[model samples]
Target: MRKITFKTLTKVFLVLVFSTTPSLVLSQVNPSPKPKSDFWNHVQFGGGFGLALGSDYTNITVAPSAVYNFNEKFAFGTALQYSYIDQENFYKSNVFGGSLIGLFNPLPQIQLSLELEEVNVSNTYQDFGEDYKDNFWYTGLYVGAGYRTNNVTIGFRYNLLFDQDIDLYGQAFMPFVRAYF
Candidate 1:
């Protein structure tokens, strides 16, 4: 056989590569389209409410919250709180505020949380037939752990910034029941 020149061999090699590359690439291409993302599918809404009535006292509370689940184990959320209290002849007050919360689940049944809250308190105190007003803003940072079920969690949180002089809740520790849907 006649000697194959280097230029001729190079041309043959390039032709083989160019002719086979398209078919090789096409064979590996995916046929299915990717699914679109749905934003609302990752969001959950829930909160807490309370009402108390007595001969000399009345209290009502409403707190609504929503969370965006990043995955099965992490969530970030926000909440709005409103409370009305009337201690008959002593005082009447309105507390309104909002909070930012972060939650983490290390196990399916255990949850941990951190929250920062701020509230505006407006109080009218009855003193010797005179009405005295006090208005202020209160801030709290809380860290907590809880037992968690599918949509409910029962736990207690301790406020790191609690002050008895403010007397908002009168204590540094508070119990909470939370649910989400």
Candidate 2:
């Protein structure tokens, strides 16, 4: 009688498994190519919305964007933004903006994003006088990353040049979301 050593048994087990497996299993290891689709198939639509209400503060926001994929790895898009804020016994403001956006996907589930925006804001001071309006243009740049799924994405971004003195967005960190059509 012969006893099989551990090393010999491992070698024998591997040989049997490989020899018994069908050649079809090994041949199908390569991934399939992506299907060709129409231009419209690569278009996606989604955006972010915000609402805040309290005795001392009221804010509402509407932002929407459209994205077209140049390829599986790159996309470019645009966004329209509007926000209004009214503070108790203080002031009221209206902000309108538009953004140019770009995205890069190095992996199937990871994304990198960049955005540039121009915002025009109108402010009416209630404490000072009646209908005293101030207007200005603000430029914003953002950089962020997120996780993506077949139909949805969730991400966070930072305002690279946040103006703390202005007090529009008190925090530099902002969240973003998207849904594909």
Candidate 3:
């Protein structure tokens, strides 16, 4: 009968471990193939909506937007906006527009954005006993920053093209909430 010594057993154990370690490392380094991702998988859709109503006033807004994520840090998108406003015996207005958006993320929790917008405004106002109509096109360029979490962002933006005399948005600074899925 033969007996194995502790030193001999330790040598055998070490040989077994060293022989299998390379295969284990190689297997992790060369994993199985994965399926390719689809184009739509990188596209996200989101927007904003608002409604206000009173005895003498009514307002409604709809904005739909979409973005294509090029990577974890960059995205490009577009948005369409429509708004209707009516004030009893005062004025009625329709505003429609579209915008181009570009976004960047410096950190997982911070987002920066640039947007260009063009809108057409048509308004009818009651001047005493008569109606007056005005129509025009307006353009806006905005730069913004926000806090981001998951698919939602809370931010404020400043319009570079805003004019106090024009009264387009009444002010250059605007707060916004954005989300995407």
For model 1 the TM-score comes to 0.79
Q: How high is each candidate's TM-score?
A: 0.79, 0.69, 0.78
Query: Candidate order by lDDT, highest to lowest?
Result: 1, 3, 2
lDDT of each: 0.96, 0.87, 0.94
What is the lDDT for 46 in model 3? 98
Candidate 3 has a TM-score of 0.78
Between candidates 2 and 3, the lDDT winner? 3
lDDT of 2 by residue, 30-91 (tens): 67878877978888998878899999999999998889999999999999999999997788
**Model 1 lDDT per residue over 51-102, tens place:** 9999999999999999999998999999999999999999999999999999
